[model samples]
Each structure stands twice: as structure tokens, then as C-alpha cells.
Target: MDAIPYLNIILRLTIWFLLTADLSVANIIIGISIAFLLPRHFASPEPLREWMRVLWEIIIAIPQAYLEAIQIMLRPHDEEEIVRERVKPKRTPGLIFLDIFLITFTPKTIVLKYEEQGWYKVHRVRRKISDQ
Candidate 1:
């Protein structure tokens, strides 16, 4: 009954239909039905101010992350160099989830696993000049 839930369903239906790219009435109906049936575990509906702040931070950091990826790729790894870094605990589960997704967007590093100790197991490609 809430506007937010209706909006959420509409958004999900739109995205689903768009991705599927079938404009048939049946498909549209299915999309709408599924959207309504899907359980919504939405992130906390905190103030937009905090969300905007986080978004700005991510935008500012993305370029630096891309640059680091480029540098790592350009550097010759004559032998395979894989480094693992332990990520520090984030303030919230949402932040940790966001960070995992953001880090995966970078080229030279991939998240291998999440450790029990609240550290991420990241596999980074690094080459030591001394090794060559």
C-alpha cells in the first residue's frame, strides 16, 4: 500500500522487462507478477543525505582505483605475482558489501573469499622489479 513498495515493484518490473527485452503482454504480466511476489529486503531507508555522501565518495575513489588497475596491468609480471590483502572491517555490513562489489570492478584484483576474521581475501596481481 505504501508508495515506496509500489515504486520498488515498478522499478523491478521495468528492469526485468528491459533485460528480457520481450514486450509481449504475457511477458510484461509475468514480470509484474514476479516483481510483486519477490521478497524485498531493502537496505535501510536512511536519509538520502548519507546515501549521497557515500555515492560521492565512491565516485571520487573510482578514478583512483581505475588508475591503480592500469598501473598494475602495465607493470610486467614475468612470473605470476599474486598478493593477498586483508581488508579492514567496515562500519556496517552494507559498507562491506558495497566495498566488495566496488573492488571487484578494478582489473588487477579479485575477491577470492571472505575470511572468518572479517577480512576479505583479495588476490592482487603485483610484479616486483627485483624478481625479474
Candidate 2:
């Protein structure tokens, strides 16, 4: 209701019009006409601000993570390498059972497969929006 409080609404409308303007200058004219024709709702700005921040962070983090994954994947590695297990092999049945139980219960990451000379994949979903 105060001066310049309507700035974001004006800016968003301008963006929407600009987005639609590629059709022609007629669209640009139409977009401009709409700014005047539309009444300002002046809704509370908090929800919009929170969503903007969340969307922005997601836009930034997703590509960064992808780039990181690519970097790790493309890094040079020796075709043949040997490493010693830091701990001696265990023969405990209870520990294995407990491990299985925990892995099954955990949600975000899932173990695809595990074995000697086999591959294991962990799938994780990034939570972007928090439940209010």
C-alpha cells in the first residue's frame, strides 16, 4: 500500500510480458497495456520472498552438483590399482544382519548392489522445499 511496494508486481508483470514479447512488438504493446489495466493485488510478500529464495538456491545447487559429479567421473584413474583393507575381514552374522536392517530402513539413499568386484549405487534425492 505504501510507495514502491508495488515494484515487484510491476517487475514480474514486465518479465511476463517480456517473455511473451518474442511473438512480436504487438505483444510488447499488449504487455505494456496490461501493466496499467491490471489492478495491484498487494498480497503479503513473505511467501513470494521465501519461494524466490528456495527456487534460486535449487537452481544454483543442482547444476553445481552435476558439475561436481561430472568432474569426479572424468577424473583420471589407474586401470589397475590395489588397496589393502584397513580392517581384517569379519565373520560376524549379527553385524551383517544389523547392517541389512539399517540399510533397509534408511530412506533417501538406497544400495543398488554390493559384492566383490561388483558396483553399489546410492540414490539420494535433494529436498528442496521444507514442509511448513
Candidate 3:
């Protein structure tokens, strides 16, 4: 069995405990049952390395997002444009969702749509350059 299912269950249980704030035996059982019973859509299970790469990307994006926000604030005069960008070829629904979230989390870019042909229609804002 892949570790992803176990990880999912663990995450669900954590959320359950956090939300219910009850660590009683009955609540533990209920949380475990709910975690297992919850519907999961499994795509052709992505390799563990791929998942790790996505996780690393997410970590890197946090500081990048802060930098982008600072840049946006310092340069208020910006131009917005839509651009098409290629996405990873092997994309699952979870990966696509995460990709969109990462892109949109940054202040300067938002993913408008994911195309059928593995492209992202991205809306981007950049500081406009002017002749001084």
C-alpha cells in the first residue's frame, strides 16, 4: 500500500481533532472511521518523488510570494497581461489544483484557466517601465 493513503488519513484525523477538540476514545474512533470512509479520488498514483517535488515547490513559493507582494506594493503602477504557459505533462487533479493555488498565491500572477492541452492561461501583473 502506498503511503499517501496513510498520510491522507493522518491529515484528516489531525483536522478532526483540531475541529472537535476532543481526544476521547469515542471521538478517536469516530475520527478514524470518518477518515477512512471519506471518498478519495485516486488518480494513477503519482510517484513519491513527484509529490516531494511539489511539496518543496510549495515551501519555496511562500518566501517568493512575500517578495512578490513587496514588489507590487513598491511599484504600484503595473501592467496586466494574459499569457499562456505550459504545465507539467503528467498532471493529476490534485497536482493541477495545487499548481493553480501556488500560481495564484503570488501577488503578481493568477492562473485564469487550465487548458485541455496542458497550458495555463495566466494573468500576470508587472511593473510598467517608463522612459525617465
Candidate 4:
């Protein structure tokens, strides 16, 4: 019984509320029950510092995502390409999920899959550069 479990429950409950858009007592009860009942598997303990770093990255990604969306809309010539990105070391399930979520949250990129040896297969769109 650590803070991780409590945090997980809170996160799940928040997501449930957001998805359902319900504030009724029954919905709250069901959301709490489901959050508690969901299975969590972690290979090792995730440090609070690492979790906070990921949370900070998530917060930063929101504005970055909006900017990317605006750039994509404004740029007329763009190119799409698949690229491999190196993942951060010592990733837990939650961290990995957040990594993927952060990458995919942006308008210009989506993670296709995780490759062997800590690489993410990402599809990205960028403005086409012109030779001057």
C-alpha cells in the first residue's frame, strides 16, 4: 500500500469521470469501484521523481501539441516520415504508457509501435524544407 496505488486510483477515477461526463453518486461509486478493481502490474517501483518528470512532460506537451496543430494547419507543404526514437531508460508500464501518450498527443506525431532495444517507431509530419 503505497502512494502509487492511490495515485493510480485517482487517475483512473478522473479518466472515468471525464469519459462518462457524469457527476451522479452512482457513477462516482462505479468509477471508484472500477478504479480499485483494475489490475496494475509494475516490474519495479517507479521513483516519485521520475513520475513527476513525466507529469511535467505531460503538462508541457499540451501547449506544444497546440502549437504543432497550428503549424500543421498553417504550413501548406509538409512531408510525412517514419522515424525511430530512443526511449528513456528504466521505463515502467505507466512511464511507457505516458511516453507513448505524450508522443501521440501532438498533432504531428504518432507512435506506431515499440521496437526492440528501447526504440519507438513513430510516424511524423513536418514542413517540407526548400533549398534556397
lDDT of each: 0.65, 0.45, 0.83, 0.86
Could you give the candidate ranking by lDDT, starting with the highest? 4, 3, 1, 2
Ranked by lDDT, the better of candidates 1 and 4 is 4
Q: What residue runs in model 4 are displaced by over 4 Å at the alpha carbon?
A: none
TM-score of each: 0.51, 0.29, 0.74, 0.87
Model 2 local distance difference test score: 0.45
Model 2 steric clash total: 0
Query: Which of the predicted structures, 1 or 2, would earn the higher TM-score when compared with the native?
Result: 1
What residue pairs clash in candidate 1, if any at all?
A: none
Kindly list the per-residue Cα lDDT of model 1 for residues 1-132, writing each as its tens digit.
335455456657766887899989999889988898987667554344444555567687789787976786778744444445565533344445556766675666678786667777777666665934
Tens digits of per-residue lDDT for model 3, 1-132: 787666557757976998999999999999999999988877786677776787689789999999988887887846889999888988876667668878887888999999988999999998788889
lDDT of 4 at 13: 90
Ranking by TM-score: 4, 3, 1, 2
Which scores higher on TM-score, 3 or 4?
4
Error of 1 at 109 (Å): 1.5
Q: How close is candidate 3 to the true structure, as a TM-score?
A: 0.74
lDDT of 1: 0.65
C-alpha displacement of 122 in model 3, angstroms?
Answer: 0.8
Predict model 3's lDDT versus the native.
0.83
